[model samples]
Target chain A: MEAALTAGIGTPLSRSAADALNSVDLTALTPGTPAFVGAVERVLTSFFTTRREIVDPLGPVFVDAAEALAQFVVRGGKRTRPGFAWTGWLGAGGDPAGPDAAAVLTACSALELVQACALVHDDIIDSSRTRRGFPTVHIDFEDRHRAAHWPGDGAAYGSAVAILIGDLALAWADDLVHEAGLDPAALARFAPVWARMRTEVLGGQLLDINGEAGGDESVEAALRINRYKTAAYTIERPLHLGAALAGADDDLVAALRVYGTDVGIAFQLRDDLLGVFGDPAVTGKPSGDDLREGKRTVLIAEGLRRADPESAALIRTGLGTDLSDADVDRLRTVLKDLGAVDDVEGRIRDLTHSGLNAIAVSTTTGPAKKLLYDMALAATRRTA
Target chain B: MEAALTAGIGTPLSRSAADALNSVDLTALTPGTPAFVGAVERVLTSFFTTRREIVDPLGPVFVDAAEALAQFVVRGGKRTRPGFAWTGWLGAGGDPAGPDAAAVLTACSALELVQACALVHDDIIDSSRTRRGFPTVHIDFEDRHRAAHWPGDGAAYGSAVAILIGDLALAWADDLVHEAGLDPAALARFAPVWARMRTEVLGGQLLDINGEAGGDESVEAALRINRYKTAAYTIERPLHLGAALAGADDDLVAALRVYGTDVGIAFQLRDDLLGVFGDPAVTGKPSGDDLREGKRTVLIAEGLRRADPESAALIRTGLGTDLSDADVDRLRTVLKDLGAVDDVEGRIRDLTHSGLNAIAVSTTTGPAKKLLYDMALAATRRTA
Candidate 1:
């Protein structure tokens, strides 16, 4: 079933990977494991469904926003964040299928809700029209505004509405987390990670905005942004939070952090590559769209550093423009010529190897550990 | 300091009012009261200061939004929500000076932060340029966008940025509340009120938007909006949540609800009058602005129902326009001529009287009761 959800399931390597993942005895170890996953799935589905229902009570303006977010959230990507959280919980000797496990999943589910809110707001900031093969919230709302013949600019109204709805989602996420019923010590342990995650995400967003405006284009600055924006929240903090909840000691948590950091950065680097080169049908976004938005990715910075003066000028101009197909092809050629693509691919290999090594050396070993290792590998090695 | 805070306190004139409130002894509070009050004050002051410091971390793009929200929130408005929560805790026979008191105050402080988030977003929804004599967050951002040579239209970017910041604030509010260390039962007790408050506020906003856009905005509909939008969350929920935490019986809770409902409506009605007629210095708003904005207040609805045909048309056009001083005066005169102002005043009196009556027959009594009674009177009788 998991293989069927993706595009290239029949390839020998892909099939093997799927088999390896599925062969892990997720349900056999303890009844609690399946129960935890079940609880998370049930609660998240209910939360989002109820959210959809409640939003309509605010009338048409909110109805449009609720519909947009519902589609955005429900389009179904791999629930990697939740998976990582659950794995961490189990790897740290926590119960897989009990209430604590449910707590981990609940926290994980809330993280996705937070991600949804962040992405919706980010799309507005970037002015992108599509995400996950559907119209972005701002764009959807803007279209509705125009369709309804509202007096002002539909885009502006739509953007405004999207922002408010995103805020609502963020608020609701907190509410869900608080009601997760974690014990006091667990709650306290999780609070700092949660707080830091928010601050880091906001800081990362600020860095991204600043970089777009040519404020921080250095490789070092770009790496700093990646650490806060992608690395911390994506893998490191989630792992740390889950382990802490499961009563992992400081050294064990530190080991997980190292693994998470590498994997997180590698995952983002892969995404950067996919954003520029992946097939649209697979990635659900247009190739080279990130380049058109002039995101100050490490790949772009490296390419510029290696390019000739004239080519460098081309890269600079291409940073924030809506590049045509021809423009994207030219940029891709320049990147290849500069060897930036090879450099990024090499980094991805190193990061994946490092992360795998961390997991191997750690004292933890179980079905959950195996699953984490497989997930980290798949996350970094994906082509799209 | 307490004396200064409660100077010129008036006694309940009615026999029932005096009897219902006889249990309160403001002077004989428990030993921990001072410490609890001090902790809350310290936390609140630090929270605001920290908020101001962190708000503009990305430079001037966010500075205006930060400043506007800071000024609006830190100004001399009564901290009634927090006060009510604390008082309710006391009224329910909880120790006024214990850790519970601190917990209640912390929870109450979180409400202020939530309110700040809601108001900032609300301003964007309403498109009001000024709030409390300062430019609204969106407007501030819009002005900054124009002032700076940023990419897109300043207004659009401003609105987008404002929305993101509001989301941030909302998220932070929930974070604070969750970290307050309230026990599960305490948290659960407060959950429904918290949830309903959010729903009502959002629903009220929708009703306001729909009503202004020429929907079926009957007087009955306007009253419903008033109850949901202003009354429930603003007073009733805060009081009820506090009382519930104190283990107040159903009768006590119900009595507070009756009192809160009446006072909350009266509070908004008085605000409508002040919106049109109060001094700018006192109200922190330009006089007659509400007339220009064409807020769908009960006063306006009443005026429309009673005004002659010619006056009604003029009022309709004036509802959402940027009215000149002469236009505002003309509309006010027409409203007065139709006796809508008098009608609203009568309603306010009735509501206040009913609220006082509810308070008179209540079984619960304490310093908290006296404080509540005073607050209800002051809220309903306010001129500005």
Candidate 2:
């Protein structure tokens, strides 16, 4: 009924349904959209608090892990996965004031745990020393080992602790959903999507690792990894899960899929671009960190494809190797002059527009569409 | 009704319940009991088969991980965790012929995955070269890297893959329970126990790792780690989960907990004994591997506590270092002279008796109680 009135095609909506639409800013994106994402930080704190209470009695060292996991999660993240999920829920005609809202929030917040696991383990795999401008999980543990003068190789001990902590976060993520008080039917609907999300993200990550290690430079492989590694978890599954929670039908779900896929890919594209070009002060990471870590992103594939022979050789030499600031600047100039950055910018614009149009055709309220518009912009045009 | 007849102090069981009791051989333990364990092999196979089907299309390299996980799970394990879970369900009045029986099996079978996660990551953390007389997961991956000449430190590469594989196995174990088709009410009862089990096991594993790294050899700490690390996960939680699935009331659950904790700790004590005294051909792992690994078992704690000063110095020297055959023999003599070996064996017998007595007094039927008795014996007296 709300959709009918909003589309200007049928009888007026009931007062409650119309009130739901009127309760928030519909004409423009409310700045409070990020509030939902921020709310997850508190949920993480509570989760760890309760977990510490339970496991500390088992052992004080367990308490240490609880603290580490909580610190890692609450320390930083845009909570973008949960944000996408919230947007998807709103877009699927679910009212934020509805009975299942808190359950939805709890379920969505579990994404942070999944992301924590990925980042913690990813840092170890990459041998990355820093994340969010701080020592990554393994490195943090390593530093603790060094500080205490612990036995065994400090690096290996740190990695072991990080591995166990990552494992705990993943397990707790599963528990978060189950303990969220979703009815059996909702849980049944949620399980397969959640399971698939986990498998695909892991698969995508493995693909990324293998591509870099195996030196596979194919654009197709890079794009595939992009789709699964970031897109699937960041946007696709979150949308699917939210829409499913809102009891979305086939057409609405299908529409959200198209929107989420394009937008998510664009989001990752912007991240890749930022990795090379953004200032350290702005991005909280050293510029050209990707060049050093050798992320096999679509942008890199494009640069390799379009660069002149000399530039191509330089790109190859600099990829996955230590890069001085001067080397980063040289690669930046190549990316710009060879038209890779321009090409990627154009692709991002196209993907974001395609995603926005998909949202437009869906039967969600106008306000939901407007919020999604802002999300797509926030994801794609942040640096620009 | 079956419980009444089993204790021989009340009315006889109904024909079907009595028939259920008579269906399996209970006297002297049927050899077909291992068949229950062998069933977990198929579950792991099917788990990988379906997991591969879902992930392989997204990335073929994921198939490699699935293969590795399946190999690790199937290659070797006593399947003892699942066995204990099955026994718990049986002893809690859950009929094997009932509708929920298959679901119980599926849920219990998931324990194999948890154990797989532990073993895989434990091998990496311990830097163990072999498990079950075969290369461990990290070692196997390292060998693959060396064979392929992959572009990274083979050790780091191996650890990375093993970590990811272990993470996947942990996630899938959660999925196994969620997808097991337990009704909502059943899930509510089961979730807390499952969650606690995962947390405690990880906690226990962390504590174990920390103790070795910190080199604190206190007997109390060793026993605490033994309880949380192996006893709680291997015996207590499995029984608790099984009993909860059968809708066992608090009293019965408490009874099972007592029985499981005793039996489980005894199980680990026997393992420690076997690690030092058993033949490599029987245990599959090298004899005295724990001493080399600096495991800090209760027996070691006792030896360290009770050995004469010169013997203690010799024992400390032999701990956590490469041991020649003569060194191993000397450490063995220290353990024997200090009465640690005899003390541990005596504790195993007493704990096993306590566990068997707890099971005997429970309201489970005659055949179930008989099976429990044999299980305690098999777990504690399995040298042959």
* Strongest candidate by DockQ: 2
lDDT tens digits, residue span B1-384, model 1: 113112211111111111211233433433225543444445555554544333333344344444555555655245667666666667677675455654566676677767777787777776778766678877976776566666656766666656666766666565556555567678667765675566557656655554554455567667767876787768877777787777777677777777777888889899988888778888767779788767888888899899788988998888778898898888889989999899999999998888767767876576666777787777877777
Contacts from the true interface found in each model, as a fraction, amount to 0.13, 0.58
lDDT, residue A255, candidate 2? 68
lDDT (tens digit, per residue) of candidate 1 on A273-381? 9988888888777788888877788898888778899999999888778899999999999999999999989988988888777777776647666877787877888
lDDT of 1: 0.67
Return the top candidate by TM-score.
2
| Interface C-alpha root-mean-square deviation, candidates in order | 16.7, 18.5
Interface RMSD of 1: 16.7
Candidate of highest lDDT: 2
lDDT of 2 by residue, B188-287 (tens): 7788788878888999888888888774678888888888888889887888888878888666676677777788889899988888888899877778
DockQ of each: 0.14, 0.28
